[model samples]
Target: MSDPGGRGDTFCGINPEALQGTINSLKRDAGRLRGSATGFKTRFDQLGIDTLPLTKLLHVASWADDQLPMLRRRHHLAVLIDKGADPVLHYPNCPDMIMVDDADVSADPPKVSDVPDGSDPKLNADWWGALTPGMRAELTFLYPDRIGALDGLPSTVRDEANRTALSKEKGQLNAKLNKLRKDLAATKAIPPSNVDDVGGAIGGDPAYELQNKIDAVQSKLSGIAAVEQGLAKGDHGGFPHAYLLGFDTHKLGHAIVSFGDPDTADDTVTYVPGLGSKLAGAEGDISRASALWQSSNQQAPNKHVASIYWLGYDAPQLAANSHGADVASESDANAGAPLLRRFTQGLTAARAVSSPVHTVVLGHSYGSLVTGRAAVHGKGKLADDLIFVGSPGVGVDRASDLHVDPSHVWAGANSHDPVPDLPGPDPFEDLGGNASSFGTNPASTAFGGHVFQADQDPSNSFSSVDLDAHSSYWDSHSESLDNLAKITVGDYGDVTEAPQIPSDVPTSPTLVGPGVL
Candidate 1:
């Protein structure tokens, strides 16, 4: 068909009403062309097209097959399921809802759930492999909280889902606040005497209802703001492979984020935070992770590196007068160990079988203890290399006890770091009746691993910062961070040795100090 303006209104019997419509029509033609051996040549001859316009049309038609559909079928299926309709009954081959049956999501009285909670590794692995990106995205919007917890899913999917859920929730809160504001304005317009003194009001005391709703909205808004602020601090400019693994807007603000994809990267570094670590403190943690990422890339430009800031478990909170300050007890570490193991295992399972990724876990201070528990109690190889810095101890009497090779395990502590010399005795007893309370000290010669120099002490330098010795491993121009980067890029020979501390130094119960963010 041709328009009155003397322009062709159709391309090869396909209407060019709009850009998207034209694209879709061309896509159908491309599909037909692909199915027929000589369709391309035949169409070219019929259109008398041998020029660039024909080439551009052919390219667009061919490319349309690769692009995701604007109206995703899975999302439409989910919308149907949300209503009372039986989607499977109507469309038997609706691929997205394969795992869910009519009984699973039926809402008359919600039935027992079949959707995996991410606890079952085998089930989640299968689920992760079964779904396509579009299907996963739809599921994320449908069940953000559930899908975000699944370890096997890609980090990018989880991040997108969480962001979508956050926006939806914020919108709901805003709507509620707007309605309350209108109600309040209407109530205020009436004189106090006109309003029923007792129970004549429709929704009870308008003032009380309005104030209550306003308080709830404000409280939720504050929580959202806190999460947003933490997210802003960790914003990585959406660099390739950067992701938010977990997010929960609540007290203590639980969130887990990663600087790279551990599953597919050639080298992966997982950093666990120690004391005083909370979701609110993610900015600082992310800053350190970003530094490590940059350093590793600079160290080995050819290698793909992923540096993750893992706050998967709740770190010990610092309270002025609480027993939580004493992290010597293995309770928190033990509890966190299983989750850490699962996280590492997930990384291993998700990677390509032919291209194995080298995984490293770095634990600082109390996090050393957390990593220790995972290495000791957890099954399978949690990581290829484990680095503990400024560690008190990894709750064992010797490094040999760790599942990983003693050679693969490493320890680093600044010469002046008080952590290794902290007043602490081994809390647990060995079979030989020897006390090993806080576990085996990783930095000790008896632990049988290489000790590297962190050299983070600022006291000997012109700087007078006190915390420098404890948490300055990643300081700019520091030898410690350089060595860490070397280790990350598999350049072990260049790492510096740790300065030896005498064995006869006075020892006390290894007490945990409040950690910095």
Candidate 2:
């Protein structure tokens, strides 16, 4: 039989006292938790710094290993596990995890009037009550019972007990807050400010961008290892794709996605991204984030708008395929027609009869060709608005050849961008204009009957173009974005001023250049 409160050779090597000591020590620092050394194995699989330890515990309890990281889990597991493991290993090691000793704070005993409430009865306004809530509660509960007798108990004793509990609670709250502060300090998240209202504010603050990048890198740093594992297993379910598109690549890609939106009332915007675009930490993603911003502004309250990020296909690198509309894309036999067909089909599938969609198709570069041909044959059907930007060709050189209602057609070109300047789809002999049939004629006017929009800021971001126009059309200070926002809300009746962009980037080319292509 086991000894009762006695150590005996008869008992196995299990030292209950040592085990209790371990439990108590951990509790002292970690809020009375006797973390299981065995159970720790289960937590070890979480794969990332569970900064909010509670979040990890919640996930651990809620999911199986298969449910661990949601989407691309196997591929992203390593990152998740690393993130989860961090809080467990690091948080308990913190010196301020709990402070039973009164030495860490100001030496003066907190006078009830001069200082705050004891927050924990065991604390007696001492400097040490700044632990965790659990720590405070445990201290409050244990101290009074251990140190004194409650004989001939009075109502006063009960009142004193309640006060002690509150103090304990305060102490625990302090500890938790300290932990939060430390984490914020470690990540160095920028303090929120009103400065973002001005575009110039982004310049002096290198910390803003640096912190953003660091956070991004750290978030997905673990994901890379996860991706490798997924690739090996040929499973990408748990992996999260994160892209960090530079100013130049994004400059081009942003133009591409924006051009893909239909410019008419029944317009549909299908946004396709380039390499390195994801929901997290990708510059392209942030650039695209503006699309939502612009759209929300346009969609004020009640408006018909449909937008989608076609993340279905992996974008090719500029080196692999600089021109998106090249024959290489459509040469697959299903080529031009089928791809466009599917897109229109999706729009048809997603429409509401009451709000019958007027078709507006926007194609950037190669996408223009896709939309261009789709409009011409009615195979993909003519949309009310067709936008072509930085396009090599829409399988034709003339806009009139597209066969859509010419009134609804539009085109845009940056001052120096050479894409539209290219011979329109002359290479693809299967299409047309091999000799001189020439595709749709360039609408060949200055944003006439077209709403030309681009980066208004003079910032050195690669996504902007300068046509040397003095007009506020591309000016950062212009109300263009706001106007766009209102447009989305179906309020085109009373034409108001454009939305103002924060002024920072220049609105003209750095060097004096040709005004037109």
What tens-digit string does per-residue lDDT give for candidate 2 at 1-517? 1233353533212222343454444334343222342255457556653345554554544343323222222212222222221121112333222112222111322232432242232233232224322233233244533211111112122223433433453455456545544554664444456247553234345555544544444444333323223222211232112111111112111111221222222444443332233323233332332353345434543343443333222332334433433333433212443434454553453233445654545554445555665666544345555655434445554555666655445554443343334343344531322211124324243222333443234443333343332122223333433333333333445334222212232122323122221
Candidate 2, which ten residues in sequence have the lowest lDDT sum? 242-251
Local distance difference test values of all predictions, in order: 0.65, 0.35
The TM-score, computed over Cα atoms with residue i paired to residue i, of candidate 1 is 0.66
lDDT (Cα) of model 1: 0.65
Deviation of model 1 at 190, angstroms: 25
Superposed Cα deviation of residue 197, candidate 1 (Å): 35
- Report how far off residue 58 is in candidate 1 (Å): 47
For candidate 1, the clash count comes to 14
Clash totals, every prediction: 14, 57
Of candidate 1, the 10-residue stretch with the lowest lDDT total is: 10-19
